[model samples]
Target: MWHAVKTLNAHNGYVCALIAKVARYSVSAALRKESVALVYKSHGDPMQVLKLQKLNLPALGDSEVLIKMLAAPINPADINMVQGTYAVLPELPAVGGNEGVGQVLEVGGHVTSFRPGDWVIPRDAGLGTWRKELVLKEHALLRVPSDIPLACAATLSVNPCTAIRMLSDFENLQPGNSVIQNAANSGVGQAVIQIAATKGIKTINVVRNRPNFQTLTEYLQSLGADYVITEESLRKPEMKDIFKNIPHPRLALNCVGGKSATEMLRHLQHGGTMVTYGGMAKQPVTAPVSSLIFKNVKLCGFWMTQWKRDHEHEMGELNEMISSLCSLIRQGKLKAPAYTEVPITDYKTALENAMKPFSSSKQILVM
Candidate 1:
């Protein structure tokens, strides 16, 4: 009886090894013949260092999902990252995108929240969605609602989330309260304006004058911006007239540093708080001592990653905010911002365009 049991165990081991070989062959057969991805070979010059090349699709890991890229935005952070100026840097020869929307092609056995054909977007940085395909851990992707526009969904990760956190994290804001922000023509700025509008909160928006300040102000106002002023206007003698009727804002959001940041603070009320999220001007933000000492004003910084880490247990709150914003889009209460969609074949041109001064719209790359 002992001899017979030993022979049976050996036969089962042989059967398991054969099954593994067949499974490997099946996976190899299922992979795409060729998929293209943009690889960063160096840091200093992004255009020269990054190149698109054909490579085999990576095998999915136990907690991973393979997504077929649908759309991605060439955001300012993405440009800075490729140029090695951004705070976070990935390993050399890494892929080069931070946000994108895609459809799940397959999910590993351990992934439970998503299945094949579900629309999803990156929830974290460095998954590098600027490719024909991607394999990311399930935790790094967020499921997007089907009703959202593909273009809008593609751009959701950073800008919208930033706006939501900035608004919600501050002390409870009422309808009559106001918020001031510079770079108000930006995606985040626009999102803040719309979100504030939904909450019946007024916005004091500031923008640098391009050749077309008239058109820009009108556009911002149409999106429910209560007041839109150019940077030059902030320095003008009659600046007080603009704020004569508006209350001193309790919250300020500054993206451009240097003088622009100082000007944003000037609009805040006594004891108001300023949150600096970006320094597009590449200069340190300076606040006059009088404002801090006499006014008791507070200065704070906002990094979305930090907020995400601290509020890990509040994902439900974040999702609720996002869903409400999406509802606004569905009702046609929100307008999709202007953007140029570049196809994969024209990625070189897209990269060049993304590096230029901010457009009135965003630049999207469609895979």
Candidate 2:
């Protein structure tokens, strides 16, 4: 089979041109079915082409499995990658989505852990998940609990993993220790707040002022946010006095870079660490050298890919942590991220909605 695939690639147009020579032979009808996929051809282009074309079900490798994508989300990272701004770039004409929940349809002969009908989620990023179906190496997928909602499971891979890493990587936060973060209304930010609450930690969330700021704050507070403040409020003269009452957070998570990062750093205690996970502001993180030298502050960055590669030994631990979070959902201790479901048939509209500014809800592509 591998030799046949290689031959097909090698012959290319020649084989098709010479099809008359083999027209008598019958081909399998299964090869004629079409599937819709989001294909990217160029970077920095506003147009995204979706193609519905015939594709044979990929033959399984010794360690591969075939899956039907159940749901996927349009994360900021997905958009960044599509726009060619992300650090990693896949070959052109590639499909765009990093996270998805799927159900296994077939498994290779040697596969031991999964079978048909089992639900799974991609364990890594850039697996071309924005399609009706996929064929991936067995190890690239993680089995999701059956009880987890398909929509929530679709977003589990990126935001939830990020939240877990942010809370675990910094100082071992105790029950009373507080942490500050910008973009507190974001998916990862919300996950962080809930996870921290589960661990008995406090969070000071900062978000841009919106018409529903009061309602938003109340919503976050319901998720166990110790305090929620607007970014504008952080610049007030009374901010310094407010700090005296709230413990100086020893760790900070900054998703919004630029001046917002600098402001977040100000709320950290001396000798504290601030990890920049994203640059949502499209600007560089600028912090005074005096803070690093005199205050002994530490600035770091986190890329989930690098972290996962370095900590392969902790896969079991990571799975356990996610399972615990799922348990919280079952007990109503953790609230799922607010989201709007977009049917896959109207993918263009979904993408447009995802690109809209200041949306309170995440956009999910429901299959």
Candidate 3:
């Protein structure tokens, strides 16, 4: 009886050891598969609504690719989207960013367009770019060259793309032709300057008068702005003096609506075009009656998101634009805007800084 009892105890100990090993393996597997994202359950102030939580990524499908995000920037549009004031809104409990660059970590069996180690950006907006990792359909992302700077790659989609499209689609601007734009220090505005300079199309940039106005002007000039003037200067009688050096602008880009836009209209050459891509002042674009009726100045708007959706069937144009911009960056003719890098763990501070007025440096979230 004593030997039988000892044998029973030994069997029970061995079973317990096996159970313990299996439990350890399960926990290790769970730890190996992890993902976290900055999510908002409801729409309101981003600071209050945005929360970081663990996410359960779906298993890779036959046409999907797994990506690990590298970096994303906080643009005013992102803040507006988070505040529920943007034109397009994602479904509830959505991620906070619309732009970023990521590297392909894995691809499904039938995914032919991308391979592991390739870099990509969302082909369209609202892909929820703030997460550390995600699995997406192969068609939803576009490959970007890995040779460019991470900052440039992360920010390439929206601002630069918008700038190029507006410059190309609106008018047939040629060398020596001038483009006037308000909010000239903006990301898109800076891109417009560099691209226009490359084509020898002059840019007359208008920025708000700041305490460091001269310094800002010099910086913009360094980026290829042909002329940098203050918003107040646009109303002055001497504003016509700018035309003496360069012809009255044939293209006017208005990100600032209302009075600034009206003043910009006064300087456009008869029959010029003004493309409104943003409303930074939260005001309506007002065209002077005379300018529209007599000058025949055209007032129009361009939304990059809508353009992408409309061109969904034709991706070749999008790919060509991205390639051209990347080439310009490689040649040092185009550059990323000034930025401040913040870790994903410290997102609140970055959001706050991004919301501050006159905050010149772009806040980029780095994973």
Alpha-carbon lDDT, every model: 0.76, 0.75, 0.84
Candidate 2: the clashing residue pairs are none
Clashing pairs in 1: none
Worst 10 contiguous positions by lDDT, candidate 2: 17-26
lDDT of 2 by residue, 227-346 (tens): 888887777766676576678888999999998889888878999999999888978888899999999889998877666656656779768867877787677766658888887777
Per-residue accuracy of model 1 over 327-356 as CA lDDT, tens digit each: 877876665577889997688888887777
Positional deviation of residue 202's Cα in model 2 after best superposition, in angstroms: 1.3
Shift of residue 268 alpha carbon in model 1, Å: 0.8
Residue runs of model 3 more than 4 Å from their true location after superposition: 1-32
TM-score of each: 0.88, 0.88, 0.90
Residue-by-residue lDDT tens digits, candidate 3, 16-49: 1100000001122224355777888777999999
Best by lDDT: 3
Better of 2 and 3 by lDDT: 3
